[model samples]
Target: MSFLTFGVGPSKLSAETAQDLRNAADLQIAEISHRSQAFAEISRRALGGLRTFLRIPDSYHILYTSSASEAMELTIQSTVELASFHFAQGKWSQYFADIAKHFRRRVLIDTVEWGQKNDFRNTFVPTEADLITICHSETSTGVACDLADIRAVRHRFPSTFLAVDGTSIMGAVAVDIALADIWLFSVQKCFGLPAGLGVMIVHERVFERAADLIARGVHNPGVFNLPAMFTMVQKDCNTVATPNVLGIYLLAQQMERWNAQCTMESRERETREKAELLGRAIEKSSSFRFLVRAPEDRSPTVCCVRSDPQTITSLHALCRAQGIELGKGYGKLKEETVRIANFPAITCGDIQRLLQVLEHVRSRTPAA
Candidate 1:
């Protein structure tokens, strides 16, 4: 059975993107040499489109990686010589902390309850921390750390390198790049592309930090640190290894259209509307409610719903029957929560159609 869902990601692609994919295959674009000008053009347009779409400043350069997790590792290993601080609100944020731990860097974390937003007003980051890792959107719990709160952290610790993980909301949300030194996310999640490709938007200061780490004889981050990657990217818009050329091609094509027909502002607005539509439907349902109760804390691109195991089972079965296969909950919340993606690829009518199915299976009893 074939299912058509655009939620979360490897989200379903639109007809236009599907055509682009087909065109790539027919033209044998993947067989081209990575060192050739053909691939450089692809990387150039993709990076340029990303800059325009995300409103990144001239001071920052976007580099390619295999995934956001790799970006996390590279970021920490590259910049954090002494210690790194994290705002841990969910699994993914904590995972970033764990990555820093792997490098033997001292990790200081300010944590909030699961599925809740980190309160930055009274938060304290140690002055000793050289890097700050903040997950702009937590995919695990559908929690979004608002950009304003991010600005608070930036204002408080201007000297520390602020790295943000915008995995679930990058393309769907409008992010002012000046808020962080490093902003990275997967192309799969919000950019409506196939998985295995990531983009790391990094400020020149991050590379400076890496250079400082090296000059001090403290520790060399390794072969493909941010500065190294930046150097290779400068030679040609290419990675040290053979990259996801197809994904890059598709992204370049998609970004061109996005920049033309739909700006980040319009997409962000639509994402909020779709997320609100899903949240309201969940609120109206008897069987489920948002895992994140506070409206502002909820994500504009990922919707997490909590319900009993039995109801969850029924919902899945029902959704699957309609070829709208819903994803199971994440990690420890596996039996309790349902995660739905509200990406740009998925239209408003599609969500409403899913809501109709949701309405039918909802429990008659009021949610507690």
Candidate 2:
């Protein structure tokens, strides 16, 4: 039997956690009264705890949904009044742009070559539009954008509300909620919980815009309605219709536990250390090269790598045989790249094990 490889999230839960979840299941509340005071308290505290962990300022508002993708859709469909500027190079980021097009929104898309740097600052202006979207960490290529750089660009557009998809980096990486109008992600990714819940931090100004759109009847009123969500969230009630109560309970417990041990600084350091450790191995391995064009822009969580196609194939086989599953390259970049996730749950030993397998695989193959 091989050790489980950590590619994305949902690798494993803490030992004590599994027990707690089983216990909660035994005492599971048969009737989930959404209006119950108990549920309201849970929702209230969960939002407070989540916002505290994210270091959201008083100017921001927090909300919950079924999934992070839902949060993204809500933010996009509700208040995207003018035009949207999308800076994307990865498969997932490209998908967000497609989502905007499906809604018939005016979209300006700027794409850099895979692994290349982009200057969104030069292309954006306050006069151009008020709705701008960006991805904080691109999992597809394991590249991260500088948040400070992005924030600086946003400073030029005081009226612009920035929407960020922070799926792979929110809890694991430090984020300033003030820099964004809408920052969203799922519990499955960085929160290290089950995938059903999406946590969103929205600025009050953005909420106002959403409300205005709702009043004007310009925004869709169904699943993507932010105004309706805001009402439920403000009252600490459920607008989610039917929530995954067990999953959310697990999330709440995990978030509280994570809050006690995981600070943004410390977790970011851990992420950096793991990335550096694996990067050293990659640098020393003559058969491998990082897929990201620049070292500074590479992500601490997702590590994208490249090698000769045959060698990459052999390495993949070796890794899978050894019980270390790797992520395949995405979209136009698939043939030349592979991705490894160094999420918080993945230990240093895990990285070492994968490196050992990689080295062994390289040794058996003839060097190009």
Candidate 3:
């Protein structure tokens, strides 16, 4: 049997975006120096548009990185001092802890069950720690933490910086950058752009602190070089090696489109509606169920599903035959779950088509 399967991320690019990519390719010329006016202008525009799209505060400065993981590494490596507290439950959250430990930063980890909610008020966070990191949405398990609740916890520790990985939720959801000291993400997820660009909106205070650390020669600034990043912004150029020119261009254009049609408030409402629609469909499907149970805590962009891996694998094969590629569950949850992304670009018709395909797959697959 053949049908389109719903899975997380790298969703089918919109035809308009595809055309924009083709246009970009046509415009590419050899030896367009990164320092030249052409590239700097592009970088400047992309940064401005991204900040506007994300509703990032004017006090927060924007910086570019190669990927979200790189942005995470930079933020963690640079600002994190002493033992930091990490909220761990999902795959990427676990990695956040692991990365911090690799940086030789002491980790105070709080782990909840895969599909369970974490009350930051209950978590034993250290007051002495300088940084606390959490994934805004854990794509692997489809658990999205309440940013407002988490920020309330941060308020208890006035000195600690809050860094959130908005990788899976950014544009599709509403995140108050003011609540968190660092909000970082990549273009591939909600921005509906191809991979290769990562953005970080950092608080002015964090930048000031980083600058002070650099002056003291006490902090080792690895990938998160605040000084260098600030310099590039002044130059109207993106730092951290050569920027992804084409990705930046496409992202800027996409942001422009998003502004023209959908604002954050509208995007958030649309995402909630789509996720509800899809979640209800999955709940009704006897062959499949949600990995994350609650809509309130679920990621609007990535829906992790609970099912037999073989069943999911078969369904994936069936979908591919129909020109639809579903995302596989990552890491420990691979066998039991699959992910479905429902962001802005994915239309209501897309969800309807996916549901139709899933129903067909269910009817054909024998009951286990």
Candidate 4:
């Protein structure tokens, strides 16, 4: 039987995206040389589509990496000279900080409890750290950092470079690209595309930082470092190495469709509506409630529910039996929470079906 899984990713792709993949294969997009004019045109179109979709500033340069994790690594390696500060609220944010520490950078992490907001406004970032990272949406606990808080942090530390991981909310929610000096996301989450491609937006100040580091003979550690990647993006909109050409093509097609059919504003509105619908259902149910208590702090894209371990496992199995899949909780909450993807690709009807199944499951089983 066909199934609809709400797992974070690889999420469902649209019909147009599926068709675009076939068309790319028919046209032999994967076989073309990365340096060829055809591939260059594809790269250019993809970059243009992303820039238009995200409202990226002219001062920022866009580059491609293999994944969001790689983007985090690249930002840490290329930008941080001695130390970096991170707002570690959940698994993903902590993971990013771990990457920096792995590189031997003196990493200072201000951690918040899971499912709570990080009030960065009052928090002081050390002057010794040159880079600060924030995950705009934490997939693990369904917690999202407020944009106003991010702006406040930027104002407090004007000289420190800011990086944001917009992994789960990029396409589904409205984002202010200028809030952070560097912003990155993978296509697998909100973009509803296959995995293996990440997009990074770097402001001019970040480029300057990389240049200064290079001039000082502080070489970036990774093979696909920012300076080399920036050089290629400037040259022909290509990557520092061979890229997932098909992924780029698919992303470009989806962006064009989104621009034509559902504007980002409409998408964000729908996402909020769906999230509220799910949130209310969870709140009313005896078996489940939102993992993140504050309504304002809850993620619009990934809605996580807290329940007893048996209930969560039974709900997972019941949903699967009905050909509907729900995401298991991540990290410390793995045994007691269930994650639901509220991405643009998941339609209102799909959500209604999910809720119906959830209600049926809850009614049949006693809350443990």
**Candidate 2, after superposition: displacement of residue 130 in Å?**
2.4
TM-score of 3: 0.92
Give the per-residue lDDT digits (tens) of candidate 4, residues 1-368: 77897998777776677788889889888899998888888888889988888888899999998999989988987789999999988999999899988988999989999999788888778899989999999999999977787898888998889999999999888778888899999998999999999999999888778878877877544557777888898998888778998898888788777777876688889999898888888877888878888899998998988877877888888898889988889978999888899988888889999989888756335643
lDDT string, candidate 1, 209-261, tens digits: 77787788766656667777889899878788888899999999998999998
- The whole-model lDDT of each prediction reads 0.87, 0.75, 0.77, 0.86
- TM for every model, in the order presented, reads 0.97, 0.92, 0.92, 0.96
Summing lDDT over every window of 10 consecutive residues in candidate 4, give the lowest-scoring window: 359-368
lDDT per residue for candidate 3 within 207-248, as digits (tens), equals 777777667775777554877787677676667577777887
What clash pairs does model 2 have?
none
| Prediction 4 global C-alpha lDDT | 0.86
Q: Lowest-lDDT window of 10 residues in candidate 1?
A: 217-226
Positional deviation of residue 353's Cα in model 2 after best superposition, in angstroms: 2.0
Candidate 4 backbone collisions, by pair: none
lDDT of 2 by residue, 178-267 (tens): 787888887776666666778788888877888888778767567547766777777665654756666666666666777888788888
